[model samples]
Target: MSVELEFEFEGILYSVVREFRGKAMSANAKFYKNNSLTTTGAKEVTSAIIKLTKMSKDAFMHTLFASQKELTSLSTLKNEDRKKMIRKLLGLEKIDFVEKELVEKSRELKREIEAFREVLLGEDEIKLKQEQIKESVTVKDAIAKEVLSKNEELEHIKLRERSIKKELELLSKTKEQKQKLFSELELAKNSKSSEILNQVKLSAELHQLEHKQEELKKLEPVKAEYTALQDQIKEQEKLKEFHLKKEGILKEQTLLREQYTKSKTDINTLERACEGYEEFVLNAKNLELNIAVLQESVNAKHTIENELKAEMAAEQKQIDITNAKIAKLHELGSEGACPTCTRPLIEEYDNVINSLVTVVNETHQKKINEHNKQLQNVVTQKAAFEAEAKVKEKEFSELINSIKVIESKLQDLKNAREYFVHVEQKGVKNKEELKELEQYGYDEKLHNGIKSSLTAIEAQYKHSLSLETELKRLVLVKADLENVTKKIEELKATCQNKETEFKLIIYDDVKHKHQLDEHESILKTVESKTALLNEIKV
Candidate 1:
């Protein structure tokens, strides 16, 4: 809660109040000395309050002027801007309503004070001076009291000064911003686009074009293959080049005749050597047949030897068994028993067992003699067959070497004959080609030049293919660049067009700026009202 300070100053009504919240303080001042307490007078009070609240002077002045343009309902305003015009219609003291007429009224009050002073003096002017001296003391005391009481109000004045300084600084900065922005606005109107916008657009176009160029790599496809094909064709033409020279034809013909004669001689020689080769080949075949016969005989003899050895082994085993049986029979005679039957041996049984043993021994010896003789004969036959097979192999090897030598000589002759034939044939063809060239008068220089360019022509063909692809890509690129350039042109024309007074964006910016100014004015109004409320609260 706050208390209002109402006082009379220079015969005019004045109200000043102070308020505080925490460390901050505010106050408001209203001069009601000019007019009666009517709704019309409330506006004057509001203007004074605006002044005392330390808001932007120019802004509030403008607002005050605008608000005072016409008087309207005060009750419609917010409580922060409360304005009541209470009339002093029934008053006991006939108190005066002081206003701008105070200057005129003050003259009257001065005359009256002078007349009353004269009346109170009652005699000597010196006595009046003495009374004036006493009154000066009281006046000094009153001044001291007023000064002591106005300390809070002085603080409010200081607060107002600080606020006013802040608003002044804000106003100055706003003025600078206005100058700078308006200059920029003029430049924007002159230019096609802002620097940033132009840079962005150009950079985008550069990037797109550069990216396309990078992506479209200019390369020839299979240059080496194309060149090789041309060289092959050139080589084929060179083989027919002999056909292009008539003077060289006679010389080539002479050479071809010689080559043909040599080929016939070589062919005859090869044929003779081939006859010898045939004889050697026949001998090798005969030796191979002999070797086959000998091998078969040797294989049969080896089989006989194996059979004889097996028989001899069987006879030897029988002899060993008979010997063991004879020894066992001797033991039986000594023991006088037949062990198998577990009975005493008779004399006739001993003779029978001995005779059986002797017969078995005689049979084993006879088979062994026959087996040994057969084995010896098989060994002799095998040796003879092996020796014959070896002689056949040696004869076959000699015949093979002789046949290989004869065949090599025949192959050499054949190769020489083939070379001669090839030379003769090529010469004949070249002779006919030369006759044809003589009829046509072929240019050696031109042919050589064309031959030299074979590889280059192939390379150019491949390069041309790459160029064709690149040209196609460039065509599309040109179209795209043209389109983009046209768009940029159109935009530039639109931007530079004198058809309108200002660009829409500039107008919008200006409009927003004015709106901000209006907001600032409203802010001052709100602030002043707040200050007044704060004072009233105080």
Candidate 2:
């Protein structure tokens, strides 16, 4: 005879075959995941079942496949053995271990608390430390005030020292000036007689040159006419150059005008294109904000759905445990002891079983159903938010594209405006230059006539310059002699004034040095006190 069994556990399907012939038995099993073979043979299948269900083979058998003979044998066992077996079947051994660990943790926590109490400060000690801090703060404040007063005195000393130094500098300058004026007075006195003799000679020569100058003065009109003609020729040359520059400017202005007109038209077109730019940008920003908000909503919903699914899985596991406990209770009957507390279940058997049923039905299963509903709701919300986000994203993309095009046009418009202004400024500068150029009025024929007259009188003009040069030398020598006499008298007066001024300024170098030393000593004292102030602590 052969027996085959098929079952599903934790979303996987398993197939088992057992054969008995001639008092020998053979067994094989296989499991599938997603309709594909995963494990084969008895050992592999057993291992896979243990791994999937998180239970040992014995416990799995006791919980799910206990036979009548086994149940009878379990009833006949000793109390301790029966209790241990039941505890293992119901997965309550971990509870005993957890209880032991909790007791140890409690003792550890109590010891830590005692240690912490030993190190904590008492109320009286805390108050004493506070008083000490308060006294330190008072001392620090007093020191700070003293420092401030010293700084004020130090600043006053610095001001007085500066004033004294300025007076010393003025005295030094006065002494130097007096010495310089005395030297100048000595040099001028030595040169005074020689300068007087030279002045007399220059006066005699000046008379002779003055008679020659009268002769040269006759050619003054011709020379003046020659100079005027040369000036006119130079002006005419400048005018010709100006005329060429004016033509170039006119050509440039014409090009500038064309460019300005074209730029104006382009600017108008660009302005029209950018008319609704602000509104489009605003709408795009709003859409982006909405999309971000929707994305957040979708993410939140996804998180909530995941949480709900996790909660449902936890609830389902709890329900499964409760159902297992209920089944074990039924199998133990009224004579069994509780698996968790190890109490006899004679009178409270129904109560224990009903309570486990109630937990599974009213608590765990109910929570699982609620979590399912919430998960479905969250999933639906996520889908809706995602759909809305997609639509908004599309709209945002379109808006961004439009904004890019508009921005490009705006940049073009900006460039056009800049070019237009540049052109306008260039035109204005050229017009001003042209206005200045227009002031030069040139007559070529009159210029030629003036050139001929200047050429004819050039010889007489050259002859007069020789006598004029000699007369200029005589005049310069006479002026120099008069300047020397005036300078000698001025130097005498300056030397006398400087000698009196030097007598009035009294600068004692020794006293100034002592004052500087005193100021430095005060500064060092102030710095030391300031350092002490900084070091003060509360």
Candidate 3:
């Protein structure tokens, strides 16, 4: 069914060779007359050839000598060919001019050939044959004319007879067609009447059902409204209950505040009492230090007095021994004897005795003076030591007072610390309780929020529930519409069936008419033959 073509032009000139389905076409110089190496030239040329054959889009012209330099050079050397090649390469040549030239040349050649053939046959020879041809032509014409006239007259009579016969056949077919149409019309009338009665009865039933559906549709909105109102009332009740719970929580908060205030006051009082106890303990410690200082001062005085008495007794014994030595020296001086022999003294012995007595008295005096000076220095040192001891005793008393105050303060501070610790502990316990109560309050509020949200959602749910019911009703309505559509489709099918039957009846009538026309034609042909025989006889 589909033909494909490939065209190739092979030769020294632009001649075309077209191939299709293994069939090849070889065109001569006439084919190359207007072709060129251009898309438009090829298209015009291909179109001209395809008018006589079946060629496809794959048609083209290929020049064999195009790529050969020697042949191209030779083709370029010819003046006319060079001009034509240049025009073709530049796409400036018109194919219409070439096609016109070819047509003119072909006409001129045909005329010239005909003139030469006429010359080859002499005029006398032609005239003799023309006369003979005229005689034969006249005889043939007369016989053919007579035969044609008879045939025409007989054909006319046969046409009239065939016309009458076909008219009779058409009348008969028309009568039968009327009877069949009347019967079909009767069936259609009866069916339409039955259908109309059924439709009336169903319409009444449908109207009653639609009326009940309308009543239900009206009641749906009212029921939905009542449900919504009920949900709102329930939510309001929950809000009231939440408010009461919040009020109770506020009361508990107030009680906790009072307890926190009382605990702080008790802690403050304990701190002040600790300060007073520290002051009392400091005064008692100072008194005990003063008593110890006085006892030490008295003991230092007794020790100094005892040491002075022992020194005075030793000095007295030494003075007594020195006086007895001075008395022995005086008695020895009164004797006046020789110092070495124990005899009565002369002038030299007296001198020696006086010197000895003077030396002993001087030694005794010096010793007494030294002892008194040393005793005075010892008494002064003892008095200074006693004063220093008194100063140290005063310092010790002050230190003891301060230490006792510190110890008493430490004890009071411990008591205060314990009291404060107890209050702080109670405060911590209260803080923990408050924390728990705050958490509980927060949880209650959160729960209330959740309940409110749930109430709101439930109200929304009730509304959506009604919408769902309406959607269900709409779905049912859609189903009814679909059923009505189906009934309409069935009626359309019946109409189509009726139309198809009518078309079949019309086709039968057309076929019978065609057969009658053929029978009339045959009868006309027979009558025409009889008329021709009668004309020949006459």
Candidate 4:
């Protein structure tokens, strides 16, 4: 028996032939691309079909040619096996496994949610804690009030103790004064005889001190003369210092005057050098303006040149297109059709060819000639503008150089003028100061004579000062003797008064200190209670 099959797959035609003679089989196949044979022989044709279809031989056999045994097995399959086979065939087994995993993950998430719910606190417990806090605050407030009352009581006790302490301190001071008075009285009694003997000797010394005082009184005129002479010497020394300062001022004035003259001369020279500053600056500005104008003209010419060149290119392109149409018309003869309209040439062929030739010569070629003329004009204008711009740029550059030189000269002039002003002001100030210094005259001869006389008088005054010091000592000693007698009487009276006052005071320092300690202990106890209350509140 022989069998032949023909089929098409993916735009390719395939053919197969098989012959079987008592289980001795032979097969041949062929495939074609676009009706052209691609592969021959069963194995080569099968491989080509498999590569084109992207399928294996077994898959191809099963998909395209199912066996009778397979059909019978499918009919006899159980429903579960059928479903399993369908799932395997459709690639849905991985989806089933993923679905099962998702279900387990969902159960785990549910459990985690329940566990989290258990760990969270309920609203009622939070309210109970808030109520406890309120009660604690109330108790703390009561304790705080008690502490305030205790503190006030402690303050009262402290004030009373402080008053008592002040009284005790005054009493102690009175006792010390009484002891001091007693000591002074004993000392005065012991020194009484010595003071009497001193009075006798002091009287004799007083007579000698009086003679020294009289001598000092006679030398007072000489001391006055010496003081006047010293004043004159100081005046002369100040005058010498002023003269030296005046000499320095004169030298400075001379230097400043020279600087002023030089600065004035430099300012004049710089001013002359910068004489045409404004004119040169204006020339530079004009040159820059001319250059800018020339540049603008050049740019305008460039724009015109570009436009003309583009127009010329378009015209030339049109001319070439027309010439091509004419050539095409000539080549088409009468039998050919028009390329653009797709019409039969017939009798209009020569007319069409003539029209194209006319367009090339009259229309496109004429436009090209006009564009060329305009382009040449633009080129000429561009060249003229560029040349003028170059000239202007050169002039601007030279003007800028001149402006820079002028500006530098002007700056020097400004600096010199400022320096001249400063020098002139300084010279005027120095001149005024020099005049002031010249007003104070000095006489060196008179100053020397007075200084010599003051030296002699100073020696005499020094001797008188010694005598005067001794006289003052004796006078102070006499006055001390009289004051001592008066102090002794006053001390006896002060002692009596202090003794009475001392007996009147009855302050008990120990008792007052004990009261203060009691108040402090009570304060500490109140503070401790307050601290405990604060802790409970927290």
Question: Best candidate, lDDT-wise?
Answer: 2
lDDT leaderboard ranking:
2, 4, 1, 3
Each prediction's whole-model lDDT (CA) = 0.63, 0.79, 0.59, 0.77
**Quick one: how many clashes does candidate 2 have?**
0
Q: Which runs of model 4 end up more than 4 angstroms from their true locations?
A: 1-219, 316-336, 339-341, 350-354, 414-481, 489-538
TM-score of each: 0.38, 0.39, 0.26, 0.45
Give lDDT: candidate 2, residue 42. Answer: 76
- Which prediction has more favorable lDDT, 1 or 3? 1
Q: Write the per-residue lDDT of candidate 4 for residues 201-290, one digit (tens) a residue.
A: 767777788788888889999888878888888888999889888889999988998898888889878878888888888888888888
CA lDDT for candidate 3: 0.59
Pairs of colliding residues, candidate 3: 9-62, 336-345, 337-343, 337-344, 337-345
Give the C-alpha miss distance for residue 110 in model 1, angstroms.
Answer: 80
> Cα RMSD (Å) between model 3 and the true structure?
33.9
Query: What would the per-residue lDDT of candidate 3 be over residues 1-538, giving only the tens digit for each residue?
Result: 1222344533333445333332453232124433543323445656766664464443322222243564467554779877776555444466757888999999999999988885586879899999999998888788777877777777776777667677667667766776676566556556655655655655555565566556556657556655665665566566556556556656655664675576456546545544554555565466456646655655665565566556655655655665564455457765555544666765555465565555544654455566566657656766665676677667666766665665665676666566656655665665565455443323455556656655655654565555555555555555665565556556556656665665565335666676677767878677668766666545
Candidate 2 is scored at a TM of: 0.39
Candidate 2: RMSD over Cα atoms? 44.9
